[model samples]
Target: MPNTQQLQDLTTQVRRDILRMVHKVNSGHPGGSLGCAEFFVSLYQNIMDRKETFDMDGIGEDLFFLSNGHISPVFYSVLARSGYFPVNELNTFRLINSRLQGHPTTHEGLPGVRVASGSLGQGFSVALGAAETKKLNHDKHLVYSLHGDGELQEGQNWEGIMYAAANNIDNIISTIDLNGQQIDGATDDVLPMGSLRAKFEAFGWTVVDIEQGNDIDAILTGMAEAKALTGKGKPVCVLLKTVMGNGVDFMMHTHAWHGKAPNDEQLEIGLAQNPETLGDY
Candidate 1:
């Protein structure tokens, strides 16, 4: 198992990968992807019980779905670094006919991706279905998913939330990146979904809050807690409070970088903030 420092190094490397991938394409969502680096690293490295090889069925191992797929840069980085695919494949991100599309798609037969998820708010339902399948098949492993807080504005998520609790899909853990900012502006300004914690609890799911979502140790600890909550008759929800465009100084506190790639100077500054640790792709 990787120790704390090793995980931290990987997280830093993943952040570098995100910045480079987006900057290369000159088109991609960097803000949310940067914000989720730690979560993805901690998850694939420490928290998950993954199989030796990749398979779409995920019969006896933990399954992860990226519902907020616009952050494909982070997801693809983690998967590759975690041995799901070639790390150098990251150079193909957002390129024509690459498996690493702007949003993850199964049509390319990507090893780590199970669903096409650029369309927001659909992950919860998809995760619920996988969780229910695990139950029926008597698979002891879990299903995990990540959602953008802003994506919850879609009505389908509430339906999935209600379905998960009502049907007692307790083996799934759904985490929301509560970064506050989205494409339009802050989620509140665009379309306020008040008190996600309250809304989740009201729906009868158990919620775990990771107030320091950017920290590696915090993500591991909080995710371990979320894992422990599995099989307890309620679906688990982790509300991770992250900063969109985390790590880069200029991009840290706003939604301006949501879907924009950094220019040459900006990429240099951003990469300097997160010095390469595990070597860049």
Candidate 2:
């Protein structure tokens, strides 16, 4: 297991990778990716029960799915740095013919990723299916999924939520990256996720809140609590309060940076706030 300092360093490196990769590609969502950096780092580095050797079936091991696939930079960085692939492969991110596409896919046989999830609101259903399969196979490991706050506007997510609750798919922990911004605009302006906690609670999910989604320690503790809440014959939902484009001053407090890559000057400014800790990919 990685120590707390190592996890912190890994989170920093993942943040650096998010910026560098997006800056290199000149296209990709940095806001959400940066916001979820610490969460992903903590999962891949310290929390998840994953294996070095990839397995498609995910039998006897934990599984994670990225519902809002626009955050591919952070996911790819964490996976590569977690020994899923070569860290140098990050240079090919979003490039033509690269396994690391703008959105994550299992088609390229990516070792760590099992689903292709650019379309929003599908990950929850997919995670429920995985959980059901785990029960069918008599496996004890859990399934995890992450969704965007704005993405919850899709109707399929509600259907999945209802299905999971009704069917008692309790071995899955679903998280919402409640950064309050999407590519088009603010979530409230676009379609406010009014009282998401209450909404999930009404849906029969055991809801938990993470006040500081950007902090590694806070995220770790929240995830541990979320894990404990699982398998109680109810689905778990974590409403993660995260700042869009966290750790970068100019990128925060606005939705303009949601899908925009930082220009040369802005890139330098963003990088200044997040120093290269474990060396940029």
Candidate 3:
């Protein structure tokens, strides 16, 4: 079993992976991807009961869906590091016909990616369907999903939230990356969905909060708690309050980096802030 220290190192490495992938391509979303590095690392390394080989059906293993697929850098890093594919493939990020696209898609047959989540708000619906499928198949595995806080404004998420709870779909845990920043500007400046915790609770789902979404230990513990809360009678929601550009000095506290790639000098600065934990990809 990996310890907290290992998880921290993995998180740091994933951050490095995110920065480098985006820098190399001069495209891809790094801010949200960086913000979610710790969560993705913890989920793949500690939470999910995954298989050694890829299975599209995921018959007997935990399944994960990326609701905000723009954060593909972090997802791709974790999946590659988790043995889903070669770590070197990250070099193809955003290139023509690359599996590691600006957003993840099953069309490329990427091993760890299950859904094509680019349009936003649809992945939550797809995750709920996967949870329901698990119930019908009598599979005891859980389905996990991550959504952007701004994406909640899309309206379809509420329908999924209401549907999961009314049906008692307790096998799924949907997490909102509550970084408070999106592409255009801060979520508040754009369109704020106040009190996500209360919102989910009102929708009949149980809610857990990780006030420090960048902290590795908190994520590991909170995820464990979320898993325990599952298999009961309600779908669980995690409000992960992360910094938009976590681990980078200049990247934090702004929405400008949401979809923008860092230049060479800026990339150097970001890498210096993160150091070289477990080496770059």
Task: Name the 10 consecutive residues with the lowest summed lDDT in model 1.
Answer: 43-52
RMSD of each: 0.7, 1.0, 0.9
What TM value does model 1 have? 0.99
lDDT of 2 by residue, 23-70 (tens): 998999998998998889888888889778998998989999999999
**Compared with the true structure, what per-residue lDDT tens digits does model 3 show for residues 218-267?**
99888889999998999999999999999997999999999999999998
TM match of model 2 to true structure: 0.98
Model 1 residue 216 CA deviation in Å: 1.2
Which candidate leads the pack in lDDT? Answer: 1
**Which residue pairs in model 3 clash with each other?**
none
lDDT of residue 59 for candidate 1: 96
- Clash counts per candidate, in order, are 0, 0, 0
Q: Report lDDT (Cα) of residue 48, candidate 1.
A: 86
Clashing pairs in 1: none
Q: Which stretches of candidate 2 lie over 4 Å from their true place?
A: none
Q: In model 2, what lDDT does residue 185 have?
A: 88
lDDT of each: 0.93, 0.90, 0.91
**Tens-digit per-residue lDDT, 1-281, candidate 1:** 89889988998898899999999989999999989988998899888899969999999999999999999999999999999999999999989989998899999999999999998889999999999999999999999999999999999999999999999999999999999998989999999989999999999999999999999889988999999999999999999999999889899879999999999999999999999898988
Better of 1 and 3 by TM-score: 1
Q: Give Cα distance to truth, residue 236, candidate 1, Å.
A: 0.5
Per-model TM-score versus the true fold: 0.99, 0.98, 0.98
